[model samples]
Target: MSDFIPVNEPLLDGNEKKYLQECIDTGWISSEGPFVRQFEERFAGRVGRQQGVAVANGSGALDIAVHALRLGPGDEVILPAFTIISCAASVVRAGATPVLVDADPVTWNMSAEQVAARITERTKAIMVVHLYGLPVDVDPILELARKHDLRIIEDAAQMHGQACRGRSCGSFGDISTFSFYPNKHITTGEGGMVVCDDPDLAERCRGLRNLCFQAHKRFVHEELGWNYRMTNLQAALGLAQLERLDWFVARKRAMGRRYTELLGETAGIQTPLPRTGYAENIYWVYGVVLEDSVPFDAEEAMKRLAALGIGTRPFFWPMHQQPVFEKLGLFPAERYPVAERLARRGFYLPSGMALTEPDIEKVAKGVKEVLG
Candidate 1:
């Protein structure tokens, strides 16, 4: 028997302990602590944003970002059908309609052309989620936004250190969001942040994160808001992780290249695209999609891999196919072929920062053995 390789394992051997010790020693464990402010400032600057509002998690950040845009009934937000449910759920929860577009078969990102086709006069924003490892073709989407007077909410949760052309992914959105989950490029145990250039928008996000509390009159709320504030402990860990982000990205790239090399000759699966016109794949997770010739779907493949002591995760189920949304009469009878196919066949291997060369070789061996 061998060790079971997890799909993700965060590496936190940086200044995480020292900063956490500082937080504990100074009694600043709440969101008001110094580390929180430091993390917010540094992370914002890193992404070329003017302000960053740290939140409890990535989904909460999406909720706040959608809310800050003041969307409601009669408003429509166009997003990808292939992304995490949080993207559409945020708009749905805001009383706005979520118009979904299909993903590009190659990149697995929302297609700009599809987005253009879905836009209506009622469209208020485009929630662009940079998927798996590559950024969405954003320049066209930006042009469409400008032409239609639409807001851009960039979901850079899987794109921490990725860029499009020469610009950072998170810097492109009117309101950009990031996740600091353990599986993400950076980890805070659990955290998220919203970054933006507009001071007013930034202020609105800050207020919304704190339950819309009045600065002059504390504990009194006027508008509705949620307590999605990130604590000092998470911030301390995030700040430390931020310092090593470039290194983490490099390690991930190396790991991806290695896996691509090892598994390039494997049959019945399609590996991630190494590069696109706008940006290279960061390999957030080294995803593999089973080909039509494959006898088993991702579920069976994952089960077989699990039997071989390898942990795997399925790709995001399409939002249009989600039963919860179906119950709400959302995306009724919607069919996105590319997204549906990817959802059924795609799964990722262990490509975490903590993964060693031996781990990669073992995982690749297991995958080849199972698929063969």
Candidate 2:
């Protein structure tokens, strides 16, 4: 039997070890260490942002960004229902209401048309979450923001190097966020960042991530905040990884192309859209959605794949379907059919940065066998 192929493993064959060694030798493992600053500057510049505020993790980045924008109490943040719960949770935690929108059938992203329809007098912001490997159609959303005098928060946590219409994903919003989870194109083990062009918004994020520390007086706080600082060790790793982002993206695209070629003719599954007019699919995880004719859903598909030593992961369950949100008395009558179908039928194969050609072949074979 072949070894079990996990869903994701990061590629760290760059200067990761060298930079980490420097940090250990220099005793700069804390969040205040020099590498944190360097990483922030480089990453911000890479994403076309003027400022970057490093945070503990992706969720923390979202929290800081939401608070920095002052979204609270009666403000409505329009977002896609087919996204990670953190998007909705961030708005909810700010005492704001999250107005859900359905996803595009082909792209499986937030529908910009739906966003225009959902806007109201109280709509304060639009949270654009770039899903999987494809950026949400952001130009229309940007137009909507401008027309309504609303703020934009781009969640590029899953879209480090992705672009829409030649513009970098992180540069499309008033404020943007990125995640450095191990499964991402670049990994800091556990880290995230908030990036923006506005100096004031950037400063607000920095203070919010550091417990709202006062510049004039120590241990004095005018407002509440959280300790969501990213450590130097993580920053060191991130800097090294960032150096190889272009290559990593290319490698991922190759892996995705190979998977598509192998599985293109397979029945019962729908592959990711290879490209749209705006951008090509980065194939973040080489996701597959079961067709309605398939006998089982993603859960059963994952079970079968696991038995064959092939790892798989289900797509995000729609926020509208979340019991917690239902309990919160949110979206009582709202229904997003596309999101609901994708959640039930979609799952991703192993498409990690560390995945080799042989691994891709094996995983593709396993998928075919299981689905057959």
Candidate 3:
């Protein structure tokens, strides 16, 4: 038996320990510190954005973006069903209804065509997620947003360095959010950032993270807010992680290419297709779709892999199918067939930063033994 390879793991290198020590030595281990500021600036620059607001986590960033948009009752925000529930929950928290849209099977992202079809007089915005580190087809999505006068909020939680055409993922939307969870392309233990070109939106995010104060003084609450601030400790980790992000992304891509080469010939598996003109794909998880003709479903496949000392994860279980949303009467279970099907059939293999070529080969062999 080999070592049990997990699906994702954080890589820690660079000045993490030194910076953390410095932060503790300076008594600036909380939100107010030089590392936080430096991380924000460097992260914004890396993503080609003018400003970035660090938050407690990716969900926090989404909440801030939703509040900044002022989406209230009766507003409809279009988003794919095939994503983490946080994306839809953010809109719901803002008092807007989330209109579920199907995803492109190849990209596993919100389809612009489906989004356009779902648009109505109540549609106020489009929340596009760059799922599995692959940049969504943003050109058509942006065109639709412009034509329909809908704001675009990009959920770039899984895609750290992905780009469509020459533009980066976070730069295309009215506001974009990213996660630095332990398993993400970069890790800050737990943190997030919201990047926006609009100074007003950025300011609103900053205010919202803290108690929406008038900024001149504390204890003066202008509007209701939550304590979603990111601490200097996390920022220190982020700053260290960001120093090697480019190298990390490159290695991730290389691993993805190798996985594709090894799995492409497997009879009942379909690998994700990288969209044309995308410069980089920081594969957060290497997803593969099992054809219906396969011998086992996603859960059974995962069980087989686990027995072989290889870890795996099933894809998101479509937001519409979740009990919370189903109880809300937002979207019926059968509304998005594609999303449901993929949720049942798709699973990701172990493609962590720490995985060597042999690790991937063992995973491939396990999958082959189970499916073939």
Which candidate wins on lDDT?
A: 1
Comparison by lDDT, 1 against 2, better one: 1
Local accuracy of candidate 3 as per-residue lDDT tens digits, 1-372: 448999887678688999999998999998998888899999999999999999999999999999999987999999888999999999998889999888877777777888889999999999988888677888999999999899999988888877888787788879999999987878898899999988888998999998887757788786898899999999999999898988888888888888888888899988867445654556778999999898678998899889999999999999989999878887764578888889999989987788898888988888889886
Predictions ranked by lDDT, top down?
A: 1, 2, 3
After superposing all C-alphas onto the true structure, candidate 3 shows an RMSD in angstroms of 1.5
Better of 2 and 3 by TM-score: 2
**Candidate 3: where is the Cα deviation over 4 Å?**
274-280
| Candidate with the larger lDDT of 1 and 3 | 1
Q: What is the Cα-based TM-score of model 3?
A: 0.96
**Cα lDDT over the full model 2:** 0.92
Model 3, residue pairs in steric clash:
none
RMSD, one per candidate, in order:
0.8, 0.9, 1.5
CA lDDT of 207 in candidate 2?
Answer: 95
Record all residue pairs in model 1 with backbone atoms less than 3 Å apart, i.e. clashing.
Answer: none
